[model samples]
Target: MNDPQFNPETDLNFDPDGVPTEPAPAPEPTPPLPEAPHPVATGRVNTGRFEPVRQLYQRICSEVSKVYVGQEELVLSTLVALFSGGHVLIESVPGLGKTLFVRTLGKTLGTKFGRIQFTADLMPSDITGAPIFNMKTQEFTFRPGPVFTQILLADEINRSPAKTHAALLEIMQERRVTVERTTHQLEPPFLVMATQNPIESEGTYNLPEAQLDRFMFKVMVEYPTAMEEVRVLKEHSGQVAVEQRLEDEVATVTGPEQIMKAIQLCSQVLVADELFDYINNIVRQTRSWPQFHIGASPRAGIALVQGARTLAAFNGRDYAIPDDVGEIVLPALRHRVVLTAEAEVEGHQVDEALRNMIRTVEVPRM
Candidate 1:
């Protein structure tokens, strides 16, 4: 007990200077800074921003009515293709407003549009452009072709040979044209509304399967109804001045910026896991089906998701639903799937097969 003179209590109180010292106080926590605005939020329409898009759609319908008398469904599908950032193939007879539809869409959207009239002698370089040698620099400067525009009207695409069609397919898939080893990216919101005369197969090279797969939709334009025919006559039967007056009355509804914004908003629409599984099952069934030689490619699946999102946005929905997938299934997969000879001989149409598949496949519940 006497040796415990070097006691624990005394030792605990002593410091290096023989004095007690307290512990340093803890530092105060720093608050976090506010976050910046999201990149996706820049041009997108929240809840209240969709009225302008609906109004724009209405104005487009009205303007297109001036030139195109009937075929409201055709007009809507064309707009769907445009809004989805996809290419369209119009299969119809001549004098069915195919050219008019493309031109009117270009005007309505206020985007740079160009028409490439396909012919037997048309070359790939003509549509994709060629490099020219500059006299001053002695360098071959790359020049862009008509496919560089926001809206490209490939009139009678099948009329051209397979080699010429390949050039367009390349552009549609890659969105970048290569000239003299230099690659140039096409502007955003690019859409190709192509038309082919179904009545004329003579001397026309049929589009290869690879080329057809690039298009998102193969729309068939049929004859107008009797009442619609009368409307067409009344609208266009007058003198050229009257038609010009009617055309002049049509105004621009939306611009390229608005279209880009809409496309951005469309991408923001959510697709759940169940819907993705549904898409996977549909695409897999195409491969395993005995009725077809070729199946839908990976690109087809991408188109399905993108097209559904676009339809969802058009319907003013913030999230994608099963109905959106059903709505776009035909257009997204029709051109991608190649039917066998037996299926064709059996008089089975692609649309019918697609509809049957859609009906058989169960939609997942939310």
Candidate 2:
């Protein structure tokens, strides 16, 4: 996949099945953006591919902001997860526009959106679908569930029981659901945007740590600031319903093919070896940290690396820097790490602990 964005301005060509038919021409070299920590170690490669990827990233950010008045980090992490082949778990109070944010992204990306409201009574069959009998044929047939869609909104995922949660584990990691020994593969560019209210637990089930680990990032969405809240109210007030507003404001700017190609391109973004050691040392310290009881797993280390690579691509660089790793470390490992009871009693937060821990790890000059 030529650089993931498939730039609208450029006229590079590709086969119908997404194979590059001709090599994209390298554009004239432009001076690199000024560096804060250090210069990018390697000169840019595949500039043709990286341009479109950057363009698409900017366009999505521009379009999604039209209707969703949430944090830039929420949008950033969501796109990072989308292009990195990862899932996101969003924690926020109800009515803070969590569903609206996901729906706006689905519309802007031009991908099919499936929403499953997870309730205590929701069964496993309801999520992954179940076998149905065809009366005329007198045979059973499989019907796929909401998990089969391109962008799935798992609303209030913590509301469902563990049995229901087990259904998602296989699909999240393997990207397929098995029923009666038959596996159904999901189409490409599939993402699960699961939401939960952190303050409510009366009738909710806590997500198992393993299930939490499956998510690439655990984003915490906060209430819009006073001015931002005013802007949302001003821009959204209308006699037309919310769906109609979405139709008019948020246009389909990209699709699944482009997204998958971007994912392929993200895998190509370079990570320096020192950065690899940088990532490893951070994860290892989490285990021995005085504040954390349970440290991150190896998967957390992988997430950090992948997220850094993808974020680097979004920034139009073919090579990743230490800033890229710093940007992803907190959200990437927040849910994966657990705080000790003493630390929790001392009013320590996971994010704070991670920030302090990473400071102890040496940052690479590159």
Candidate 3:
């Protein structure tokens, strides 16, 4: 019987005189290493797929920082919402650079920017535009409004009447506006960055729950740190005109195509099967918790997953992990959940509720 484990080359039987050995057999070939998939191409500028995404992200941060000064969390969270294909609601007092930040982002991406100073009398037509009869042509022509742009800064959005707010509902969700029974599609990569003053409730209409739900994150832009304030002052201490020129001066880091492609890439990020259950578990618990009058909706769960994937990609990973889900749960769910009167009386906060839920839920071992 032949020896199965025997190798003619390695297992040679040498004669008493070593010189009497037969020639050695050929050696076995070494197996090749498996190759990884190439990163997805981003756009016309093929600066190596994922590398440009990360580089552009960092470049935007650097360029925006030149004028916006500090507020890294505010900037990053906004990017997360953008890349996740969701809108953002910013709560801050006037002069916190909320409008400037949105404009800077728009300029940085080379996308069209529009700003609507939402007031008590700001009409729906003022935002979504209307059809006007062309006397010469004898036909009604559809006129596009600022909302038709890629990035919209709805300044003091809550100050507008509920009717005006309602105008945004369809477009925010469906990305299309209807006027005179005709629907028009908005340009791609449309994001609404609405601002509100949390300290003042007078003359401000509370955002409808549906409107609030449309936002993926409700970021509170606070006063800058002492150092940041100093830097901001120094950077803008130049001519007021120069200060206003920052957005215009910003070189385009990317275009609408790349921004849209990056968003698509983020959507395609891998979310393990177990993570879906984990996300659902967290969202489901919000409903049954004793302190809550309203829990996060199904849409909130989807937002959490999407936001997590964006974060994972921002960190240069194709696959999402538990930490990715955890990092965004609070911001993504904070505005979505409402506290009961009893809980509010007890000083229970939505963030606290989320923290407790995080501690209670069993994080699946990846």
Cα-based lDDT for every prediction: 0.71, 0.83, 0.77
How much does candidate 2 score in TM-score? 0.91
Which lDDT tens digits does candidate 3 get at residues 216-284?
A: 988878899999898888877777664367636666666776677677766766787888999999999
| lDDT by residue for model 2 (64-161), tens | 88888869898999999999999999998888887788789989888888899999999999999999999999999998888899888899999999
Clashes of each: 0, 4, 0
Q: How much is the lDDT of residue 62 in candidate 2?
A: 82
Model 1, 1-366: lDDT tens digits are 012122122222323332223321222333321221222444333342332333445556777776767886677677777777788888888887676667677776777888999999999999998998899999988888888898888988888998898888768988999877788899878988888887878988989988887888777888998998888888777776633643586556667766766565566666778878988888888886777678898878877888777766555444566777776677778877778899999999888887776677777765
Q: What TM-score does each of the candidates earn?
A: 0.80, 0.91, 0.84
RMSD for each of the candidates: 19.7, 3.5, 15.6
Model 3 RMSD in Å is 15.6
- Clashing residue pairs in candidate 3, if any? none
Q: Point out where model 3 deviates above 4 Å.
A: 1-49, 242-244, 247-249
Error in Å for residue 82 of model 3:
1.4
Report the number of the highest-lDDT candidate.
Answer: 2
lDDT of 1 at 310: 70
